[model samples]
Target chain A: QQQVKQSPQSLIVQKGGISIINCAYENTAFDYFPWYQQFPGKGPALLIAIRPDVSEKKEGRFTISFNKSAKQFSLHIMDSQPGDSATYFCAASMSAGHNFNKFYFGSGTKLNVKP
Target chain B: DAGVTQSPTHLIKTRGQQVTLRCSPKSGHDTVSWYQQALGQGPQFIFQYYEEEERQRGNFPDRFSGHQFPNYSSELNVNALLLGDSALYLCASTPDEGFGGYTFGSGTRLTVV
Candidate 1:
């Protein structure tokens, strides 16, 4: 079973527009949700992360809106720029175990911001 | 501080051959994690290493083995490589016992022919 599911494998948005990518997960034990951004020829980097307690978190132009009960989360890039064009991934993790790691990830959303 | 670093930006290997990829953790980091990303796909967790031991592993098979050095650096070794083994191998570094986000390496692009 795909624990995490993301919509719109690819997306296109105008520069300065709002680029929204949504994801849903099946595991309620997951309390931490993080979003990652990847540019061409680079590894994915953690853009921002949020715990389930908060409804939303904003860091610069990137925002993560999480709905724990709904088991869904979304990333919104406000004032999207061509530089923001990259692949985005949503991941879930339970703060358990001595290992201290998370599990499950969305297929990833490729965002293209046209200038 | 210097970020995570990986070796061999690209590599080509024949099927049935073995290959090894290396990673150096970021300054001050004590944990290392490895992921596999196929073209046009999200990265898949292979395993994580801490305290020179394998702390956790993903759905990857035994063919995918790893070792962590005392310096927090790590190595990923794949045996009897198959076509499916070709992918971008990434290494992530983070503080051993913190909630900090991981810093990623540039990744080694592996092509199993």
Candidate 2:
């Protein structure tokens, strides 16, 4: 079973425009939600992360809006740039106990920003 | 500080052969985890090691096994490789206690024929 589900397998946006990707999860045990950006031939880099306690967290142009009640979260990238054209992945993990930090990742959303 | 480092960035093996991959965690990190990523797919967790012990594992088959050394380096071993085993194997590391994100290596591209 896919623990975390992401939508819009691919996305395209003009430079300086806003790009958004959404994700949903079913496991209530998940407490840490993180977003990663991966370039071809490289590893996924940690972009930003949020906890269930906060409804939203923003870092630079990247923002994560999380809704614990709905079991959903979304990533918003402001001022999308061509350099941002890559794959974005949302992951959920338990932050405590034995299963702590074992990430369950979404399939991923490929983003393209046309300059 | 160096990030996670994986060895033999690429490999090719025949079906029914065995393979081993190595990883060195970032400085000051004591935990290591392995993940398999198929083309165009998200990474699937294989297992995690802490304090030189296997602490948790995903739903992978027994053929996928791992070992963690006292120095916090880890190795993943696969017995009797299959074509389906062809994928990018990634190694990630984290501190023993923290909610911090993992640092990942570039990964090893494994191709099975």
Candidate 3:
């Protein structure tokens, strides 16, 4: 079963507009939620992360709005640009003693920013 | 300061053959985990190693095994490759099981024929 589920398998946004991607999880044990940006032929890079204790986190133009009670989280990009076109994946991880950091990733969202 | 590094950027093997992939964790990291990503699909966890021991594993078959060295590097071995085994293998590292601090390598693409 997919522990985490993401919506909008693909999205296209106009430049200078706002782009959003959403993800939901069923496992309550997950405490850390992170967003990764991946370009073609490259590894996924950490974009932003948020803990369950926080309702929201923003780094530069990237923001993660998390709803702990709803078991959902969403990433928002402000003033989206063509450079933001790439695949975005949302992942969740929990610390469980020795096995502490196994991450469950979402199916992934392909974002396209049209200039 | 180097990030996770994976060897054999690309490989091709026969269906009956066995393949081994290597990974070197970033400096100061001690945990290594392996993941398999199929085309257009998210990565699936294979297993994780810490302190040169297999600590946790995902729901993969016995054919998928891994080893961790004292140097904090790791290797993933897959036996009897199948066409479905063709995918991008990723190696990730973290200092410990914390809330964050995970890093990933570019990945090695494996093609099974």
Residue pairs in candidate 2 whose N, alpha carbon or C atoms collide under 3 angstroms:
none
Model 1 misplaced stretches (Cα beyond 4 Å)? none
Give the worst 10-residue stretch by lDDT in candidate 2 chain A: A92-101
lDDT of 1 by residue, A10-103 (tens): 9999999999999999978887888999999998889999998899999999899988888999999999999999999988877776436745
Candidate 3 C-alpha lDDT tens digits along A2-29 = 9999988999999999999999999898
Clashing pairs in 3: none
What is the TM-score of each predicted model, taking all chains together?
Answer: 0.97, 0.99, 0.97
lDDT of 1 by residue, B70-109 (tens): 9889999999999999999999987867675678999999
Determine the backbone clash count of candidate 3: 0
Residue A114 lDDT (model 1):
98
Write down the lDDT of every candidate, Cα atoms only.
0.90, 0.96, 0.92
**lDDT of prediction 1:** 0.90
* Per-residue accuracy of model 3 over B2-107 as CA lDDT, tens digit each: 8999999999999989999999999989989999999888889999998999889999999999999989999999999999999999999988734574789999
Q: Which 10 residues in a row give candidate 3 chain A its minimum summed lDDT?
A: A93-102
Per-model interface RMSD values are 1.8, 0.6, 1.5
Comparing candidate 1 with candidate 2, which one achieves the higher TM-score? 2
